[model samples]
Target chain A: MSVTDELLANNAEYAASFTGPLPLPPAKHVAVLACMDARLNVYGVLGLEEGDAHVIRNAGGVVTEDEIRSLAISQRLLGTTEIILIHHTDCGMLTFTDDEFRTSIRRDTGVKPAWSSEAFPDVEDDVRQSLARIRTSPFIPHRDSVRGFVFDVATGKLNEVR
Target chain B: MSVTDELLANNAEYAASFTGPLPLPPAKHVAVLACMDARLNVYGVLGLEEGDAHVIRNAGGVVTEDEIRSLAISQRLLGTTEIILIHHTDCGMLTFTDDEFRTSIRRDTGVKPAWSSEAFPDVEDDVRQSLARIRTSPFIPHRDSVRGFVFDVATGKLNEVR
Candidate 1:
């Protein structure tokens, strides 16, 4: 089957696991900004249900312009009041330098000027930096409560990094 | 020091790493729905950068009404053309039965009239099941491409399970 067909199959079984209709709280909602790593299981860690939280993720769980836009929507429009930022140890962002990543992309895509030194660079600093940017961003409701944590990919533990 | 102070210190250092401005690409954007588990790193696996993708996540990385809402917005406004569902091995989604989770939340939150059974549930099937849901979701854009993968938390590797 094609990739699309496969995705449908997986989602079907996943959906079937939910025997009942789990919904989110309408009044007090939470938003999570986390890395795209597979190791940090936010639901299991937080003891959450299917619709309990709003999670936004990216590499290193960093805050970007789009992330800010989404955060603003979640807080101002969607009723999300608390924000959790989760970074992790042994991140791939720590593995390579920006120059290295650009080189790899150039070789793979065969595109001249593939990405600048700043494009894919700066993974290691994304976590703490992203938290600050999100916390202070005027776009996000200033009153929202924001916290940051570091999830250990190897240990499956979360520590309050902020 | 206060959490705010820490956030500022780390973020300032983090922001200094961005030495150059990067350009945005016009390629079709992809949305990755995955688990919040700390074991998997989506960036290194996908080789992504800032402004490249949208990641919506939950406990098992399972799709729910809210996740769908986010997906709806992501596709309707954010120019996303694809969805990638990633589930992983040794997930907590498979650890506790639904009864256990409901009981725990009830005891802790003191909010009875237990919510839907779909809250935090088990992940029984493999990658194929997750893939099927994404492909068949009526709400997902028909033109969008969707795929599924299972990441091994222990090995830090991913196999296209679907």
Candidate 2:
């Protein structure tokens, strides 16, 4: 069976005892932007329960225009006042360069993407970059409340990125 | 204390007995793109453990250029094959329109965004759009294995979307 089917079965069990209908705005007025890595449990690692925070994730957790767009809406409309950017060690993003990945994809598929992969060699540096992006964005109203961190997949630890 | 400080303290407790060093590639060969709603535990509801699957999340879990970029790398380099697009009920995306939200942000920060918020009227239809985006992306190598679902945040249930 596909993993989707397995997950569907699992969701059935989860739904059987589900108790929710959490508030629309997060209780803490916080939002976390973190890597989509399977090992990093943003909520569990951070001790956040349902309705506590909004978690925005993508590969590498790097801030992008789209991410800013989301954050704008998150803060302007949803009452979120804080942002946390988290990137992790051993990230696939750390494994490649923009040029090399572009070339690789170009060879695999006949089309070349116009956007950069936003890859970086250092996870902490990437985190700092993301933090800066959020801090400087005109759309984000809670710039001073933003911070960044690096999650160690092996140790399950998060180290602050300045 | 900020939520980041609280999360750091929690991470210390979590890291004390942490054990990992899982292989770089996910064991399940699947990637799930879901909303970053604090209530939807992507891993728990899907019965996924660390190192099993890659979970990519954003505001609405909408398929954007960056998401496709990430999927390209997920499939081309990391060996992830199947893709699951999941959107949830009562999403913040459902609370406003692109134009209305743009107006709000513009009013709040005097800066007009150049991109769309990707807001939608129907969560199920948004799931279908994301699925189609993945299925048609030239960068994604495992398009044939793509599927879509709408998760019920209130009930912890996921309904397939065509």
Per-candidate local distance difference test: 0.53, 0.83
Query: lDDT per residue, candidate 2, A1-162, as tens digits?
Result: 877788789889888988887777888788899887777877777877777888888778989997897788778878888888888888988888999999887887777899998889988877878887877888888776888888888888888888
Best candidate, TM-score-wise?
2
Model 1 accuracy (lDDT, Cα): 0.53
Please, what are the lDDT tens digits per residue for candidate 2 over residues B12-109?
88888778867778888988988877677787778787888888888899999989977887888889989988898889899889999888778877
Which residue runs of candidate 2 sit more than 4 Å off their true CA positions? none
TM-scores for all predictions: 0.49, 0.97
- Pick the DockQ winner: 2
iRMSD in angstroms, per model: 14.1, 1.3
The residue-level lDDT of candidate 1 at A57 comes to 69
